[model samples]
Target: MSAERTGVQTRITDVAALAGVSIGTASKALNGTGQLRDSTRQRVKDAAEKLGFVGDARARALSSGRTYTVGMITTDSFGRFTIPVLLGAEDALSAGQMAVLLCDTRDDHVREAHYLRSLAARGVDGVIVTGRSADARLPIDVSMPVVYAFTPSTDEADVSITLDDAAGSALVARHVRSLGRQRIAVVTGPERHRSAVRRADGASSVLGSHLVAPPLFGEWSERWGRQAVDVLARQAPDVDAIVCGSDQIARGVCDRLRESGRSVPGDVAVTGFDDWDVMALASRPPLTTVDLRLEELGRVAGQALLALIDGGMAASASVAPTLVIRESTVGA
Candidate 1:
């Protein structure tokens, strides 16, 4: 009655027949290739499931001339940012029945080179390069298609997906301004960091003369955020809002503000970038911040890389940020 019981392998033709589509269409649907409607793809998949059909990896490789695998190289050893990106990529790649090989370079050039050679040797179809920072880096020397996530490729021609840092920072500035916070101060990470510079510039562009003082550049840590409050007291004692470059910094600012008998939102509204749950949600009044949507960025990068692997053109793109409001900016 069934292919398993009859000792016959269930073929794509059987699936096509059951789904009322041509063999080519079925192949395309199963292989995640060609343009097909969602309903059509679902029909074919359902038919395959009913027939207990399993595509053979060896046959697929032979027919497609691909190893059905991709490599992800990340320099973020702690996986703070890279993990979400990797998870999003996996979600996209798994839909096409592709596997991912992770390579952690730990910011070592020698180790990175080794991993590159190793991925090449293993015949990975493509590589996705990512890092904790959003700064651009030199493209990896590879013949196959490559996509950069978070850390963009320096080459304009390469396919890179990165967060829109300036736009995100602008959102924060506008949010604070909308709250009638006239005296605003920005506190962020190192001045040399591209993200910090972009965020500061974006907020400056929006707040303009309302920006009470120049952005305070320091470490991307709670300590810096706490210390910044003291400086703000002396520099802009009447500051009504503090825009932080990171959720960690915002949490620190909230804590310090509370200790100083200042009510969050009532006395000093605060905003942060990177809606990191651990910091954003844990803050005294919760933080109103810009969500970078790193996972979505990774999904886009994966889709772009897949297109490139499928003989599509390469292009660089940016993902817009989302504004997440909380009690920090608006009273609960």
Candidate 2:
């Protein structure tokens, strides 16, 4: 008999009976808990769907002593980076039927503290802290499981999911070298910034003696990229390639290079980090750039947070960067 015909509420036991699994296994599969085979979990889920079964949240909460909700705290007011992370996290958490509460502190310490307290009061199972930059920030003092994303926690013991920036820079350096570009230059953001410094160092490690001049440090803007061309003209007039710290800077460099009568790839190849589509696609010849895979990082962070909530240990890890080849480095 169909559950709708009898107007009887379907239970996990009914789902288990239909799926030929024990009630315990059905419960674990539905709740996204316990160790079960993927096929077993999927079969149980299919049975539950066929039976139109839905678990009672109140009873489940009482049994588990968990609210089944998590908090996502971000300091990125612009949502430029946080949005993708949030989307990926949502995807991961949906499998567990867990809810997420988003809190944006806008880089205000006092505001952040308030959100932390609020999340604790709401009885979130855990929290994921993130920011726009890769610079490490102080760890949150919450008693719940905490996972850091993008911007890591200063404490080494905390779980942090970050991008492999140095490796990404090395990829760009190697690609330009493969194109037979001998004289290369680097242009990036502020010297004090960890991301800029790491990227420059990574490229330098690969280019070595082939690097034409010291990396130019300035703001992360097209204006700085345009200005860098002037400096490179004076220092390495015959430079054949430029590795930029960001897509915006690379676009600017391309613009300035065009103005200076240097044909891209034919005369000088260009590469950028952060495959930001708007900047990379709009550039004259497009940009060959590094994909930070921020969404994947977020998904990993979400999984780590979930593991912590489930009494599993999660270690700090980094996602490898992906090099995207475009017309900027290779002529069309």
**Ten-residue segment with the worst summed lDDT in candidate 1?**
1-10
Please list the C-alpha lDDT of all candidates, in the order they appear: 0.91, 0.92
Expressed as tens digits, the lDDT of each residue in 161-214 for candidate 1 is 998999999998998998888999999999989999999999999999999998
Structural RMSD, model 2 = 4.4
RMSD to the hidden true structure, all candidates: 4.6, 4.4
* lDDT tens digits by residue: candidate 2, 52-75: 787787778778899899999999
Error of 2 at 206 (Å): 0.2
Query: What does the lDDT come to for candidate 2?
Result: 0.92
- Candidate 2 lDDT trough over 10 residues, lowest sum: 1-10
Clash totals, every prediction: 0, 0
